[model samples]
Target: EDKVVQSPLSLVVHEGDTVTLNCSYEVTNFRSLLWYKQEKKAPTFLFMLTSSGIEKKSGRLSSILDKKELFSILNITATQTGDSAIYLCAVRPGTASKLTFGTGTRLQVTL
Candidate 1:
Protein backbone atom coordinates (compact mmCIF):
# COMPACT_ATOMS: atom_id res chain seq x y z
CA GLU A 1 0.00 0.00 0.00
CA ASP A 2 1.16 3.52 -0.73
CA LYS A 3 1.06 5.96 2.15
CA VAL A 4 2.18 9.46 3.13
CA VAL A 5 2.54 10.77 6.67
CA GLN A 6 3.02 14.33 7.87
CA SER A 7 4.56 15.41 11.13
CA PRO A 8 3.42 17.94 13.73
CA LEU A 9 -0.26 17.24 13.33
CA SER A 10 -0.99 20.71 14.60
CA LEU A 11 1.05 23.87 14.99
CA VAL A 12 0.53 27.35 16.38
CA VAL A 13 2.35 30.32 14.91
CA HIS A 14 2.18 34.05 15.21
CA GLU A 15 1.99 36.31 12.20
CA GLY A 16 5.37 36.70 10.47
CA ASP A 17 6.60 33.39 11.84
CA THR A 18 8.00 30.75 9.57
CA VAL A 19 7.07 27.06 9.62
CA THR A 20 8.15 23.86 8.05
CA LEU A 21 5.96 20.77 7.54
CA ASN A 22 7.47 17.38 6.98
CA CYS A 23 6.15 14.49 4.93
CA SER A 24 7.55 11.01 4.66
CA TYR A 25 6.21 8.20 2.56
CA GLU A 26 6.38 4.53 1.74
CA VAL A 27 5.03 3.88 -1.69
CA THR A 28 5.15 1.33 -4.41
CA ASN A 29 5.93 2.52 -7.94
CA PHE A 30 6.01 6.11 -6.73
CA ARG A 31 6.00 8.71 -9.44
CA SER A 32 5.53 12.05 -7.73
CA LEU A 33 4.87 13.97 -4.55
CA LEU A 34 2.17 16.60 -4.34
CA TRP A 35 1.44 19.28 -1.78
CA TYR A 36 -1.81 21.07 -1.17
CA LYS A 37 -3.30 23.61 1.19
CA GLN A 38 -6.79 22.91 2.48
CA GLU A 39 -8.68 25.88 3.80
CA LYS A 40 -12.19 25.56 2.43
CA LYS A 41 -14.06 23.27 0.10
CA ALA A 42 -11.12 21.50 -1.40
CA PRO A 43 -7.38 21.41 -1.34
CA THR A 44 -5.49 23.84 -3.54
CA PHE A 45 -2.41 22.56 -5.33
CA LEU A 46 0.88 23.97 -4.08
CA PHE A 47 3.65 21.89 -5.55
CA MET A 48 4.28 18.74 -7.57
CA LEU A 49 7.67 17.09 -7.46
CA THR A 50 8.79 14.39 -9.80
CA SER A 51 12.03 12.97 -11.13
CA SER A 52 12.52 15.75 -13.61
CA GLY A 53 11.34 18.53 -11.34
CA ILE A 54 12.17 18.04 -7.70
CA GLU A 55 11.59 21.50 -6.34
CA LYS A 56 8.85 24.08 -6.56
CA LYS A 57 8.27 27.50 -5.05
CA SER A 58 5.59 30.13 -4.88
CA GLY A 59 5.75 33.32 -2.89
CA ARG A 60 6.35 32.39 0.75
CA LEU A 61 5.86 28.70 0.09
CA SER A 62 8.34 26.18 -1.28
CA SER A 63 8.79 22.42 -1.33
CA ILE A 64 11.43 19.87 -2.21
CA LEU A 65 11.43 16.15 -2.79
CA ASP A 66 14.05 13.50 -2.08
CA LYS A 67 13.20 10.28 -3.89
CA LYS A 68 16.03 8.33 -2.31
CA GLU A 69 14.86 9.32 1.14
CA LEU A 70 11.19 8.97 0.16
CA PHE A 71 10.31 12.23 1.82
CA SER A 72 9.48 15.88 1.18
CA ILE A 73 9.32 19.14 3.09
CA LEU A 74 7.21 22.25 2.80
CA ASN A 75 8.39 25.65 4.02
CA ILE A 76 6.32 28.72 4.64
CA THR A 77 7.93 32.03 5.56
CA ALA A 78 6.40 35.07 7.15
CA THR A 79 3.14 33.32 7.62
CA GLN A 80 0.01 35.33 8.16
CA THR A 81 -3.30 34.47 9.78
CA GLY A 82 -4.60 33.93 6.27
CA ASP A 83 -2.08 31.16 5.85
CA SER A 84 -3.79 29.07 8.53
CA ALA A 85 -4.90 25.85 6.92
CA ILE A 86 -4.40 22.14 6.78
CA TYR A 87 -1.45 21.14 4.66
CA LEU A 88 -1.71 17.83 2.83
CA CYS A 89 0.86 15.65 1.20
CA ALA A 90 0.01 13.02 -1.39
CA VAL A 91 1.75 10.54 -3.64
CA ARG A 92 0.84 9.42 -7.12
CA PRO A 93 2.01 6.49 -9.14
CA GLY A 94 2.82 6.35 -12.85
CA THR A 95 -0.22 4.26 -13.57
CA ALA A 96 -2.80 6.50 -11.97
CA SER A 97 -3.82 10.11 -11.52
CA LYS A 98 -5.38 9.41 -8.16
CA LEU A 99 -3.27 10.29 -5.14
CA THR A 100 -2.94 8.75 -1.70
CA PHE A 101 -3.20 11.54 0.84
CA GLY A 102 -1.67 12.04 4.23
CA THR A 103 -3.65 12.81 7.39
CA GLY A 104 -2.63 16.46 6.97
CA THR A 105 -0.87 19.04 9.18
CA ARG A 106 -3.04 21.76 10.58
CA LEU A 107 -1.48 25.19 10.98
CA GLN A 108 -2.91 28.04 13.00
CA VAL A 109 -1.48 31.50 12.51
CA THR A 110 -2.55 34.22 14.89
CA LEU A 111 -2.11 37.94 14.56
Candidate 2:
Protein backbone atom coordinates (compact mmCIF):
# COMPACT_ATOMS: atom_id res chain seq x y z
CA GLU A 1 0.00 0.00 0.00
CA ASP A 2 1.18 3.56 -0.76
CA LYS A 3 1.35 6.00 2.11
CA VAL A 4 2.30 9.61 2.78
CA VAL A 5 3.14 11.46 5.96
CA GLN A 6 3.32 15.17 6.57
CA SER A 7 5.21 16.69 9.45
CA PRO A 8 4.12 19.40 11.88
CA LEU A 9 0.49 18.61 11.21
CA SER A 10 -0.44 21.95 12.70
CA LEU A 11 1.45 25.23 12.57
CA VAL A 12 0.87 28.89 13.38
CA VAL A 13 2.89 31.77 12.03
CA HIS A 14 2.66 35.52 11.76
CA GLU A 15 2.83 37.60 8.64
CA GLY A 16 6.20 37.64 6.86
CA ASP A 17 7.30 34.42 8.56
CA THR A 18 8.83 31.76 6.41
CA VAL A 19 7.75 28.16 6.91
CA THR A 20 8.84 24.84 5.54
CA LEU A 21 6.43 21.90 5.26
CA ASN A 22 7.60 18.32 4.92
CA CYS A 23 6.19 15.25 3.22
CA SER A 24 7.50 11.71 3.10
CA TYR A 25 6.15 8.69 1.30
CA GLU A 26 6.44 4.94 0.89
CA VAL A 27 5.18 3.46 -2.31
CA THR A 28 5.75 0.66 -4.76
CA ASN A 29 6.57 2.60 -7.92
CA PHE A 30 6.40 6.33 -7.51
CA ARG A 31 5.33 8.21 -10.59
CA SER A 32 4.88 11.77 -9.31
CA LEU A 33 4.43 13.95 -6.27
CA LEU A 34 1.79 16.63 -6.05
CA TRP A 35 1.11 19.50 -3.68
CA TYR A 36 -2.19 21.22 -3.08
CA LYS A 37 -3.68 24.03 -1.06
CA GLN A 38 -7.18 23.47 0.32
CA GLU A 39 -9.12 26.50 1.46
CA LYS A 40 -12.71 25.95 0.45
CA LYS A 41 -14.43 22.76 -0.66
CA ALA A 42 -12.10 22.46 -3.60
CA PRO A 43 -8.38 21.98 -3.47
CA THR A 44 -6.14 23.99 -5.72
CA PHE A 45 -3.19 22.40 -7.45
CA LEU A 46 0.19 23.76 -6.43
CA PHE A 47 2.84 21.68 -8.15
CA MET A 48 3.61 18.28 -9.56
CA LEU A 49 7.15 16.95 -9.31
CA THR A 50 8.30 14.01 -11.42
CA SER A 51 12.07 14.17 -11.32
CA SER A 52 14.15 14.19 -8.20
CA GLY A 53 16.07 17.24 -6.92
CA ILE A 54 14.28 19.62 -9.27
CA GLU A 55 12.51 22.43 -7.49
CA LYS A 56 9.11 23.79 -8.57
CA LYS A 57 8.19 27.34 -7.67
CA SER A 58 5.39 29.86 -7.97
CA GLY A 59 5.06 33.17 -6.24
CA ARG A 60 5.97 32.67 -2.57
CA LEU A 61 5.70 28.88 -2.71
CA SER A 62 8.29 26.36 -3.79
CA SER A 63 8.74 22.60 -3.52
CA ILE A 64 11.47 20.06 -4.18
CA LEU A 65 11.29 16.33 -4.71
CA ASP A 66 13.63 13.57 -3.56
CA LYS A 67 12.91 10.22 -5.12
CA LYS A 68 15.88 8.53 -3.53
CA GLU A 69 14.83 9.53 -0.05
CA LEU A 70 11.13 9.21 -0.86
CA PHE A 71 10.31 12.67 0.40
CA SER A 72 9.55 16.24 -0.56
CA ILE A 73 9.49 19.68 1.02
CA LEU A 74 7.31 22.71 0.49
CA ASN A 75 8.44 26.22 1.42
CA ILE A 76 6.34 29.30 1.86
CA THR A 77 7.93 32.68 2.41
CA ALA A 78 6.43 35.99 3.49
CA THR A 79 3.31 34.27 4.75
CA GLN A 80 0.07 36.13 5.16
CA THR A 81 -3.33 35.36 6.61
CA GLY A 82 -4.40 34.55 3.10
CA ASP A 83 -1.90 31.72 3.15
CA SER A 84 -3.70 29.98 5.98
CA ALA A 85 -4.96 26.69 4.62
CA ILE A 86 -4.47 22.95 4.56
CA TYR A 87 -1.52 21.81 2.57
CA LEU A 88 -1.93 18.39 1.01
CA CYS A 89 0.60 15.97 -0.41
CA ALA A 90 -0.27 13.19 -2.78
CA VAL A 91 1.59 10.43 -4.56
CA ARG A 92 0.83 8.76 -7.87
CA PRO A 93 2.02 5.40 -9.02
CA GLY A 94 3.70 4.43 -12.24
CA THR A 95 1.32 1.52 -12.75
CA ALA A 96 -1.99 2.50 -11.25
CA SER A 97 -3.70 5.78 -12.04
CA LYS A 98 -4.67 6.79 -8.55
CA LEU A 99 -3.52 9.26 -5.96
CA THR A 100 -2.78 8.52 -2.33
CA PHE A 101 -3.09 11.52 -0.06
CA GLY A 102 -1.55 12.30 3.29
CA THR A 103 -3.28 13.54 6.40
CA GLY A 104 -2.21 17.04 5.40
CA THR A 105 -0.72 19.95 7.35
CA ARG A 106 -2.86 22.78 8.58
CA LEU A 107 -1.26 26.22 8.65
CA GLN A 108 -2.67 29.24 10.42
CA VAL A 109 -1.28 32.65 9.63
CA THR A 110 -1.92 35.46 12.08
CA LEU A 111 -1.59 39.19 11.80
Candidate 3:
Protein backbone atom coordinates (compact mmCIF):
# COMPACT_ATOMS: atom_id res chain seq x y z
CA GLU A 1 0.00 0.00 0.00
CA ASP A 2 1.16 3.52 -0.80
CA LYS A 3 1.61 5.64 2.29
CA VAL A 4 2.32 9.32 2.78
CA VAL A 5 3.52 11.19 5.82
CA GLN A 6 3.62 14.92 6.47
CA SER A 7 5.77 16.64 9.03
CA PRO A 8 4.77 19.32 11.54
CA LEU A 9 1.12 18.37 11.62
CA SER A 10 0.24 21.96 12.44
CA LEU A 11 1.82 25.38 12.23
CA VAL A 12 1.23 28.89 13.55
CA VAL A 13 2.62 31.96 11.83
CA HIS A 14 2.03 35.64 11.51
CA GLU A 15 1.27 37.45 8.34
CA GLY A 16 4.17 37.77 5.92
CA ASP A 17 5.86 34.69 7.30
CA THR A 18 7.08 31.96 5.03
CA VAL A 19 6.48 28.27 5.64
CA THR A 20 7.59 25.00 4.17
CA LEU A 21 5.62 21.75 4.45
CA ASN A 22 7.11 18.36 3.79
CA CYS A 23 5.62 15.17 2.43
CA SER A 24 7.24 11.79 2.10
CA TYR A 25 5.85 8.64 0.60
CA GLU A 26 6.57 4.96 0.07
CA VAL A 27 4.95 3.11 -2.74
CA THR A 28 5.36 1.03 -5.86
CA ASN A 29 5.41 2.39 -9.40
CA PHE A 30 5.39 6.00 -8.24
CA ARG A 31 3.34 8.23 -10.42
CA SER A 32 2.91 11.73 -9.04
CA LEU A 33 2.52 13.88 -5.96
CA LEU A 34 -0.25 16.44 -5.69
CA TRP A 35 -0.57 19.38 -3.37
CA TYR A 36 -3.85 20.99 -2.36
CA LYS A 37 -4.96 23.83 -0.12
CA GLN A 38 -8.17 23.40 1.82
CA GLU A 39 -9.54 26.61 3.23
CA LYS A 40 -13.11 25.54 3.49
CA LYS A 41 -14.93 22.39 2.50
CA ALA A 42 -13.33 21.82 -0.85
CA PRO A 43 -9.63 21.54 -1.49
CA THR A 44 -8.09 23.69 -4.19
CA PHE A 45 -5.39 22.22 -6.37
CA LEU A 46 -1.97 23.70 -5.82
CA PHE A 47 0.69 21.68 -7.60
CA MET A 48 1.40 18.33 -9.20
CA LEU A 49 4.91 16.92 -9.25
CA THR A 50 5.76 14.08 -11.56
CA SER A 51 9.41 14.60 -12.33
CA SER A 52 12.20 14.98 -9.88
CA GLY A 53 14.20 18.21 -9.62
CA ILE A 54 11.41 20.16 -11.28
CA GLU A 55 9.82 23.03 -9.43
CA LYS A 56 6.24 24.05 -9.87
CA LYS A 57 5.18 27.52 -8.79
CA SER A 58 2.11 29.71 -8.72
CA GLY A 59 2.20 33.08 -7.07
CA ARG A 60 3.56 32.71 -3.54
CA LEU A 61 3.21 28.97 -3.50
CA SER A 62 5.75 26.59 -4.96
CA SER A 63 6.55 22.89 -4.79
CA ILE A 64 9.27 20.49 -5.81
CA LEU A 65 9.71 16.77 -6.01
CA ASP A 66 12.61 14.52 -5.10
CA LYS A 67 11.74 11.26 -6.73
CA LYS A 68 14.94 9.66 -5.58
CA GLU A 69 13.94 10.25 -1.99
CA LEU A 70 10.26 9.63 -2.58
CA PHE A 71 9.32 12.95 -1.11
CA SER A 72 8.12 16.45 -1.96
CA ILE A 73 7.94 19.87 -0.37
CA LEU A 74 5.52 22.75 -0.62
CA ASN A 75 6.60 26.28 0.20
CA ILE A 76 4.45 29.31 0.81
CA THR A 77 5.93 32.79 1.07
CA ALA A 78 4.56 36.07 2.41
CA THR A 79 1.56 34.34 3.78
CA GLN A 80 -1.60 36.19 4.68
CA THR A 81 -4.38 35.45 7.16
CA GLY A 82 -6.32 34.12 4.24
CA ASP A 83 -3.60 31.60 3.69
CA SER A 84 -4.63 29.77 6.84
CA ALA A 85 -5.79 26.38 5.70
CA ILE A 86 -5.14 22.70 5.65
CA TYR A 87 -2.55 21.61 3.18
CA LEU A 88 -2.85 18.12 1.77
CA CYS A 89 -0.40 15.86 -0.04
CA ALA A 90 -1.61 12.96 -2.09
CA VAL A 91 0.17 10.31 -4.12
CA ARG A 92 -1.20 8.38 -7.04
CA PRO A 93 0.20 5.46 -8.94
CA GLY A 94 0.64 5.36 -12.70
CA THR A 95 -1.89 2.60 -13.20
CA ALA A 96 -4.80 4.20 -11.35
CA SER A 97 -6.22 7.60 -10.48
CA LYS A 98 -6.88 6.72 -6.86
CA LEU A 99 -4.86 8.85 -4.49
CA THR A 100 -3.55 8.08 -1.04
CA PHE A 101 -3.70 11.26 1.03
CA GLY A 102 -1.50 12.22 3.89
CA THR A 103 -2.74 13.43 7.28
CA GLY A 104 -2.75 17.12 6.19
CA THR A 105 -0.85 19.93 7.77
CA ARG A 106 -2.93 22.68 9.30
CA LEU A 107 -1.51 26.18 8.96
CA GLN A 108 -2.81 29.19 10.81
CA VAL A 109 -1.69 32.58 9.57
CA THR A 110 -2.58 35.29 12.00
CA LEU A 111 -2.64 39.03 11.55
Residue range 1-111, candidate 3, lDDT tens digits: 899999889999999999999999987798999999998899999999999999999999999999998899999999999999999999999888999999999999998
Model 3 whole-model lDDT (C-alpha atoms): 0.94
Query: What TM-score does prediction 1 earn?
Result: 0.94
- TM-score ranking, best first: 2, 3, 1
Tell me, by lDDT, which candidate is best. 2
Model 1, span 84-103: residue lDDT tens: 99999999987788899999
Off by over 4 Å in 2: none
Off by over 4 Å in 1: none
Instruction: Tell me the spans in candidate 3 whose CA falls farther than 4 Å from its real position.
Output: none
Candidate 1 vs candidate 2: the lDDT winner is 2
lDDT of 2 by residue, 1-111 (tens): 999999889999999999999999998888999999999779899999999988999999999999999999999999999999999999999999899999999999999
lDDT of 3 at 48: 90
> In model 1, where is the ten-residue run with the lowest total lDDT?
48-57
Candidate 3's TM-score:
0.97
Per-residue lDDT, model 1, residue 57, is 86
